[model samples]
Structure formats: structure tokens, C-alpha cells
Target: MVIINPTISTQPAALTRPAGPAPVLPADRVLNAVVLGERAQHLYELSSGSLRMMAESQTPLREGEQLQLRVLGKDAQQRPQLEILQRGTQDISPQLRNRLPEQLSLNQLSASLNQIRQGENPTLRQLIAPLLSSLPRRQQLSDSAGLQKALHNSGQSLEAKLASGEAPKGDIKAALLKLLATVQAQSPPPPKAGLARSYGPSNTPSPSVHAAGSAPADIATPGTASTAKSASAPQPQAASTAPAYQAPPKPLGLPGELQPQGRLPPSPPEIEGTLLSRLAHDVKGALARQDANQLLGLHSREHGGSYMIELPVRDRDGIDVWQFQFQPPRTERDHSHNERGSQHDTTQTGWTLSLSFDLPGLGAITARVTQQEKQLGIRFDAVQSDALELLRQHTPELHQRLAEKGIDVAGIDCRRRSAQALTESSYSLSALLRDQA
Candidate 1:
């Protein structure tokens, strides 16, 4: 006899495989692709993973920058002819949308790092200590070389360091990512059970049940004593043996463990949290914030706008987060830095460095330093009278230090910061610098 089995079917396989047809891109449908630089002059290579085509872009496009495109139509060669909607990082619209919801304030991250020296996790402490040590000391800001070093290690050039195929060993962002991964690995796996179950409900029942069926053949008859006494009577064969069922002694949260029918220990109103876990959360938030800042910087670059970096300086007292803003010359936007070179470095152009931070004895202070030729103009604003006086007293020493580095300071100006100072800094940095002067 022939038998046909219905246990297997090719229908399931057919359902899983997608229909053998190409995806349709309707005309004028918005698409996103990365610009792969110039093919020839104004012509650019644009790709959206599955497709690549060349299109002429009126606006200059940089390689590896994402572009928002709209499908206009196909060319005579059947290649996609597209219009550039938004260029360069989608103008970072996507980043702001995704990152802002998850980001925590940088101040919280600094506080967490401050507690690291006292952390019990030696592995975590070791991971971050090296990065912190790489940061420039406050004293290093007195000269140009040290300032450049600070800029390199500020975590702002982290992407550049990676793109250049160099190890970002001493970079703060790299270390934070490492720490985040380590801490995340320690998170307990989620419980897999669907619901509460009795003692090892997932385990197999014992084979002892088979023992009940393995009796002598004559045992069925009570009056078979005569037959049992016969010398030729067949002996009973042994049944397969297996260990009896045993309930595992694991906690309720663990897999295949029994959920006891008793009251559990009540959770407390508040409990002290672990340092490593807390630090992990803080690091995650800080990284998100960094991602947001980098996005903002990408959008600002086209306009020759300023970029801000928060440098956390750890000291004997505590960690202090200093904000530094660097603004390139306005003309620098039009011409590439390499192309401009010595021509742009002339005394006619100037660069601005603005700093804001708080000190142990001194109150909140802000400084704006402008460089023109070999000469520098320093303007400091302080909220406290004592802080202003102290800065004024140290102006001559600051001037002397800069002069030693061939940085001549025409004058050092100290002023009292007003209530409108924060307001001014938020709106126009130029105005803030002007008001300080």
C-alpha cells in the first residue's frame, strides 16, 4: 500500500518568501539617501542602499552626509532623476527628533562621574579614570599649544579620530560607550515563563509510572500459586528505571522554578541603588545629549556658527564642568580651511574663544577672548563682587602667561555680569561678547 503524508507543505515557504517584484518609488515620493561626493563637478552620487544613481545638485554636497531627496522621474537611461529636498545630515532633523526624548542633562552625568572614585566596581572605575586623566588641566589653558591639546581631547573630535583609523583610547565618548556596554551586559535576563506554575511544570514527569505495569505474568491470577511453584515458570523481566521526580530549589524569578503559594517579601518604599547601574543610566543619557549636540553642530557648520563643548575637570574638591565655545571667522565658511590656509590666517581675520564655568571660591564667571594677529583681547564677567575683584587681581598674571607664549594681550577687561547676561548669551553670543567688553 502507498501512503501520502500531509505533515509537510511548501505553502509555508512560499508565504515567507517575498513576491519577486521590485519596490516601486512613486514620482515625487520623499526619499532619503547619503551623498557619495562629486562624480564630476556639480554631479553627485546618491544612494539609498538598494539603488545608486548620479544626479546634478545645485547646492554643494559633501560625502557621507545624508540627503533628503524626492523622486522626480527616471532618466532616459532608467536611472532615478531626483530633487534634493534637505541636504547634509537631513539638516539633523532626525537626530533632534529621536535623541531629545531620551537625553538627560549633562550636569547629572558630571555628578555621576564625580562619584566614580568612591565606586565599589573596580572594573568601571578603571574604565573611566584613564579618560578623565587625559583631559587637559585648568592651568594648560594659559598657552596656545595646551589649548589645542584640550580641543583634541574634548570628545568633539571623537568622530574625526575614528574616521582617521586611530584608536580613541583616551577619548571620553569612547570610554563612556565602553562603560555603557559593560553595565548593560550585567542586566539580568528577562523571565521567560508565560505565567505562574507549580513545581517545575516545564519538566517531564517521572518514568516511575512504568514500574506499576511491570508485574509477573502469573500475578494476575490469585489462585495461580500452583502454576508459580512450577520450575519452568518464566521469571519476571525488569522494567526501564529512571530517577523519581524532584522539584528544583530555585527562586521564583528563575526558570523552571516552583512559584510558592505563600506571601512574598514586601518591597520597601525606597532602596539604595547600586553605583554601577546608576552610572550606566547616567552615561546613557549623557551620550544621548552628546549625540544631540553633534547634530546641532552639523547644522551650524554651514553658517560658520560657534560650537560648544562641555569639559568636565575633576579636582581634589569635585568635578567642575566648563563650557567652551569656538567660533571660526565668518569668511571661513565660504572657503575650505586648507584652501584658505595662510591667506586666512592673516591679522585681518580673528577667532573667538568663550568660556563659562564656576569655581570653588569664586562664583560663576564667563570669559571671551578674541585673537587678532599676535594680539588678544580678554574680557571677563563675574556675578560676585569678590570673584570680579579676584579676577582683576589675577589679570596681570594671566597677561604675563599669555605673553610668554607669544600671545600679546592688548588689554584684560573685567566687568560685573548682569541679570540679562544669561539672556544675552542665549540669543546672541556676539552681543554677549560685546557686552562683556
Candidate 2:
């Protein structure tokens, strides 16, 4: 009886459960906005209801384009992150609408110039000749010798600037913008009946074809070739009576399972070796000058390309090594032609960075960070059991490291993966290691 009384306690031990982290409530709302300006890395400064916020986009948005954006929470800096749900039906300013086309043309011209400087397009004359010829007529620069001189001088100046390792000055850009705005104010010419054809159909045979046909006669009668040719040549004849042969149109699809069922492969990368070399040189120059904006431009060109950035740091093991590799967001090009005979391409932009190192007693670990517009993601891959346990025990250290590098790690996730994950694009490990050495 005494043993029973001792076994039965007076009060039961209180069962306590550990408290969980606080829940995050999503903030989603719709807002009317207009793009006011564009900055490096495709970030746009937008105006909405007494608020000015920065927004990132995969495609370039023209200034004054009305937008209906879904506000999807704020970033670490408290800037409202936006997701464009729809294009606004509200009318834009008449001046902006009128100048939009001219603005777009000018932007394309500027991009072409940059591509030429980067050596992406080796035949600069072929690309710039049309723009140069049309500029005088379209912008009314034919009579303004000073403006024409400025345009000509700007080309040489740009070359010199590139050679001297100087950032692109905005003077030429400002002049071009002003000229385009003025041109937009003027009335456009009335539509002609049709675009003039570069080559027209003709009944007359080409001189080369005629010579080919008369070659046998000349070879056979070298002594009397002139007289024979004169006698054999036709005199002012009507068009040939025979009709030209035409090939039948090909079928739209294959006979059976061979038919194409999905989207085509993306267009090839636009940035070749020459362009990459030029960009690398420019990036080094910018880095030497500590010009962050200029460095951003080299990586964030209109066309997608791969780049590598390394920062030296001491790891948890107290070993000095490169801590990070930055690959700026890039859009893959999917080119298509519209009914109007104009070419267009689609692009997708997302920023990615990776970190790799080995702990003193543990094995190798790699961390990948990706950000697409407003969303951010983190993944830990190729982790050993011991290292995984160690990382779980000291997870805060990873966050601190990222924060020190100016990366926001508030909403990031940490996980252990048995196998490494494949990226949309390769990480260029060889190139990165070579550069580090």
C-alpha cells in the first residue's frame, strides 16, 4: 500500500510543447502604375498612388506604359515587390503614345551599337548603314550640319572611350533621345502604295546568263566569234513563251508520329567569344575604376550571356578562398517573325549565385541562391551526413555569411540534398576555377 501511494504522484507532470515560429501572412493587392525610369539590371522605377517603388522585369517596359501590378509583399528593404498581372486599358499620354515607336527604334539602334562595340556583330557597317541613312531623313538632320557633325563625331568618340577604358558617356545618348523626341513631334509621311522592292522580276536575261549561253559558240569559232555572235543574237524579241516552273508547297506536318508537337528549340546564344572577350575586358576596366554601374552594364546586356564574379573570404574552417560566384540574370531568346515582317524575341531573366567550400572536419558543401523577379530561393546540394548535421546545428552561420555579402536571407531555406541539382544553365566551373588561379 505504501509503494502504491509513492508510485501515484500527487500531480501529473505538465506536458509542454515547444512554441513554433510565427506565421507569415501574404500581402497581395492590385495597383495602377506607370514606369518612370529604368536602371541597371532591368530594374524599373515605377510611380503608383503616391508611392515610388523599384520593380524588376524580364522584358523591357517602355516609360509611360500603363500597368496593373499585383503587389506581392515587400523585400528586405521594404520596397513593394510587384508582379505584372495585366496591362492597363487606360489611355497613355498622347505625346508618349506618339513617341513610343520612335523611342523603341532609337533603343534598338543603341543596342545595335553596343553589340558592334562588343564585337557580337562583326559587320557594323551593314547594321549601322541603314540607321545612319534614315536618321537624316527621319530626324530632319539634313539641314542641320552641326547635328550631323555631332553624330559623326560621336562614333569616333565612343571608339576612343572604349579604347581608353572609360565608361560610356551619356552625351550621345541624350542627343539621340532629343532628336528622336523632336522627330516624333513632326507628322510622319503618308503611306506609300508599297515598299520598293530591292530586286524586281524581269523578262530580260542577265548579262552573266547571256555570256554562259554564248560560251560554246565563242569556243567553237574563236576567229569568227564577233561575226557569229552578232548574227546569232536575237534582235528586240518579245518575252519567252515558256512559263517558269514552280515547286509545290510542302505539307504542314509529318505523315505520322514524326509531326512536331511542341515548341521549337531556343535560338542560339547571341554572345560569342568575341563579345565575351570584349565584355571581360570592359568588366575588368570597370572593376579597376570601382564603377559598379558600368560593371552592371557589362553583365546585363540586352542579350543573355554567362559571367563569373569571385570574392575572397575566409570560410568556417579559417581557410582563405573565393566565397561566391555571381551569374547575372539572362533571358534566352526565342525569335519569331510577325505578320508585319518584323522580328521579335521572348526572354526570361533570373539571377543566380553559388557557393562551394569544405568544412575543417566535414566534407564539401554547395549552396545555390536564385532570384526571379520578386521570388527568392536557396538550396543546399551534395552534402555529407556529418556536414549536414553540423550545418543543421549552426544554420545561423550561413544566413550571417549571406547577409554580410548584402544578400537578403530572411525568406531563404536550408535543406540537405543527397545529390547535386542541375541548373538551367551550367555554372562554368572550369572557367571560374581558371580565373581564380
lDDT of each: 0.53, 0.37
Q: How does model 2 fare in lDDT?
A: 0.37
Point out where model 2 deviates above 4 Å.
Answer: 1-303, 311-318, 332-347, 393-437
Residue 394 of candidate 1: its Cα lDDT? 91
1-437 in candidate 1: lDDT tens per residue? Answer: 00001111111211122223333567777878887655654455667777765544434455667877776666443444556667653444444444543454454556656566555657656766765676567777666797777767767778777545468866777777776887667643222332112111223322211222221332211111233343474533223122112222211111001111111122222111244445565676668767655655665575567667766665665666666766776443332366547333323558887887767677667788888777788998887899899989998898888788787788999999752352122223222223323
lDDT of 2 by residue, 1-437 (tens): 00001111222212221234312324566667787765533455677777665554544455666887665665554444556677643222232212211111112122333455444454533433333332222223224584344343332244345334455543343233333343334323312321111011122222322322222322211111234444685533224332221111111111000111111122223433323322222222212222221222232343244333222121222221122345667667777778888576857657876665443455556677788665567776545677677666676786777678677754545566532231222322223223323
